[model samples]
Target: MAGSAARELSFLTISFDERLVEVGSNKCRDAFRELFDHFAPRLKSFYLKGGSEEAAAEELVQETFVLIWRKAALYDPQKAAASTWIYTIARNLRIDRLRKEKAMIYKEEEFFATKLTTHETQTDVTYQNQMNTQLAQAIAKLPAPQAQVITLAFFEEATHSDIAKRLALPLGTVKSRLRLAFTRLAEMLEGSKQ
Candidate 1:
């Protein structure tokens, strides 16, 4: 395995570290693909040596490559060789994966525990309904013009400019109406809590 890795590293035709640098500065996909082709199988073997199954090894290898892609800009060729940097990423990911697997507390009744928690969901739904009622009452109190703008802006998901266009009002008028409407709604909602 050691001999194979050494031969593979030596077989890279281009300056692998330089290619990594290119990937960092330029986001060159082809450079990344080249790195992937060279390092993935070797990393897979290393993961398998650590007792990961084939699927786990492949997942770890893929995760390592993803980390390498995201953190390529942090890689310094002067500080470490490309192989060393890539291996470090693979090692870290595998360690994290193993930690997560071991961290899981196996409670066979865990699913049942979640299923039994209906009161919390019921409380959430009740709170949501109360808020909705307060909101509807507050909106009903808005003057017709302000309510129109609010309806368009909130319920219809229209931007201020779109509201302005739909109402044939100036942009400043639309903004002012929205500001006034929001201010009134805030005051009403705050007063309701008291």
Candidate 2:
């Protein structure tokens, strides 16, 4: 009797999934409008809770629905409900944005440290000066090839194989350079305290 009840519940769930897929596939605009109308507030709250600004959260919500329109055909009714799939898309977009933001920040820091002139009198000067000195010292300590590999990996965001191809070096050589560079950097930082 319990087994029969579980089967019945599964059947109902499948039927709902199919209906949503059909709605998404055929009456796409109307289906999306309905979904957006229902879920917009929830999505805004979701993004806000996840630390996005209200304006950015609203934009992300809109982008999510736009993706739904484009990727509706890729939805698998057997795998998830419409709400779950939409939420997953929203979450993935947020994570992608965060990664890009982090990469941009790192690039900016690298650029400013290299390009900006130093004025020793400013209050902000002390920290920037220390960072610049440490970074230069670290890079200087690395062997030329190892330093090149680390710079390409961190600044260009290249994979080991990509770095290998760019430098025309073997894959193992690129990996070795990265490992040796990081080890040297750690040791340099550690020794500087004494």
Candidate 3:
């Protein structure tokens, strides 16, 4: 069994290397097709065994062949076997993908960091203090029940159900009070703006 397997591998190496040369020199579609058919599954298995997920394995195989097609003219059977050339392409593609993913994560973190810093540095502390004072006055002007729901929902970060349970009120009652409080706050804030 091992001997037969070795024979088959030998045959594949010889033919696939020749096919790659054919593809490079003649732009031969048939040779390219043969190479793709033989190597795609093997490349996918290689990636999967290297800890890539199935979908990622398939993607890497596709990218490797596309690259192999484009770069076939650069392949030199004198330097390496066809399988070696293909696997090297696949490995490079995987490394490129990992680099891109890492770069995206780094960019996202950088963006958020800059955004937070800008907001903090550019804020008008006096304006913020004034708005807080106005908001407090407006809440005090709300009827007791409406203020309670608003405070619980916004300040304490309670859900409507939790606010209702805390206040011994129905969920619907909590929602209505929050809506009314929002309307009053909007009017008061708008009036102050004018």
Per TM-score, the best of the predicted structures is: 3
List per-candidate RMSD values in Å.
Answer: 25.4, 23.0, 26.6
lDDT of 1 by residue, 104-144 (tens): 43321224434564434332322323333455566777899
Please give each candidate's TM-score: 0.45, 0.42, 0.48
Clashing pairs in 1: none
Residue by residue across 1-194, what tens digits does model 3's lDDT show? 85575556555667777799898888999999999898888787777765688998898888887878888887655444566567566655655666877544543332354456453343332333344346656777789989878867653546789888988998988898899999988887556434
lDDT of each: 0.68, 0.64, 0.70
Which 10 consecutive residues of model 1 have the lowest summed lDDT? 121-130
Q: Model 2, 16: alpha-carbon shift in Å?
A: 7.2
**How many angstroms is residue 23 displaced in model 1 relative to the true structure, after the best TM-score fit?**
1.0
RMSD of 3: 26.6
Clashes, model 1? 0
The digit string of per-residue lDDT tens for model 2 on 1-194 reads 85575556445444444545766678555656666676778778777766688899899888877877777776654334555566666666766786877544443332353346343233431232233345455676677898888867754446789889989999998998789888878776556433
Top lDDT hit: 3
Model 2 scores a TM of 0.42
